[model samples]
Target: CLGDRAAVALSRAGHFRGRTLFSGMLYAPLVMPEVITGLSLLLLFVAISAERGFWTVVVAHTTLTMCFVAVVVQSRLHALDRSIEEAAMDLGCSPVAAFLRATVPLIWPAIAAGWMLAFALSLDDLVIASFTTGPGSTTLPIRIYSEVRLGVKPEINAICTLIIAAVTVLIVVASLAAKLSKTQADNAAPM
Candidate 1:
């Protein structure tokens, strides 16, 4: 939700001053080293006296992944025909209503893709999670790393297999859903 809103704002930012500067700042995390990003987040948390825990980890991951999501969504938005949304508005729909009813459906695929990307990044993230996580908030990657230091175990292999299986299932489901949605839309269209 946050990422989509950011993408919309940034995509429309071309009409505003300082667009280039704002865009560069927003996308800077893509090129910045993970260590640097993690460190900066840690410093920010400390400065604000925020406890390093699950919520902090969530915030950290969101901060890191939102830009990627924005990029994906912005690309889809760029490819989208604005006339469809405009037409909805022309037919007495408020701008917000038009965006929700017309624009959102058209961009749903990109939103889903962005969400998957963000989930994957958060799932495997180590550095940022490490920096932000505290007691009782150990993430899967951090736990795996700690366990591996003592020696690899059969449980580790099992866990890895489960993770792989889960990801594969998620991908298959997403693709199937997309295909089903497309089919439904096709069938619903007028001849």
Candidate 2:
């Protein structure tokens, strides 16, 4: 799954020979909003929903989320060791098996981290969510935004504190796990 994700990200990024300049240019525009991304997404939703409903919003959100995820996973793939994969292939594994066994394990943590980052981004997205969501598809970010706009309250602070705590915990745990895995791998290597 990790290799697949990394590969998909690389493929989508238009990366060739491990280059990622194209992806950076593409995503840079998206991270900022000129006209409020929500309004743009809303316009797209109206045009598309002239054809369908519930799934349209999901599709839009997935596309939006995948853009960010791909950029992250592509960077992870680029940083990976190419020699390990070549060694796996030389040992008689097929290309896919080599990627699965050698490349995937090394990059799995990055891919998992990207997934969490993407999830957090998606959860916190408000403008896009507000524009793209149908009647029944309002997300947490959208809900919170709506409430805050109406007026600030104690619950908003509670929610903000919870979000901060969760993100901090995730970052700490992921860092420790990466450090531990690198130490164990280094120790296991023949010396």
Q: Which candidate comes out best when scored by TM-score? A: 1
Best by lDDT: 1
lDDT of each: 0.91, 0.68
Lowest lDDT 10-residue stretch of candidate 1:
11-20
Estimate, for each residue in 66-174, the C-alpha lDDT of model 1 and write its tens digit.
8889999999999999999999999999999999999999899899999989998889899998999988879999999999999999999999999899989988997
lDDT of 2 at 144: 84
The reply for model 2, stretches above 4 Å from the true place, is 1-37, 50-54, 182-191
Clashing residue pairs in candidate 1 (N, C-alpha, C atoms within 3 angstroms): none
Per-residue accuracy of model 2 over 119-180 as CA lDDT, tens digit each: 77667666566666677556777778889999988998999999899889988987898799
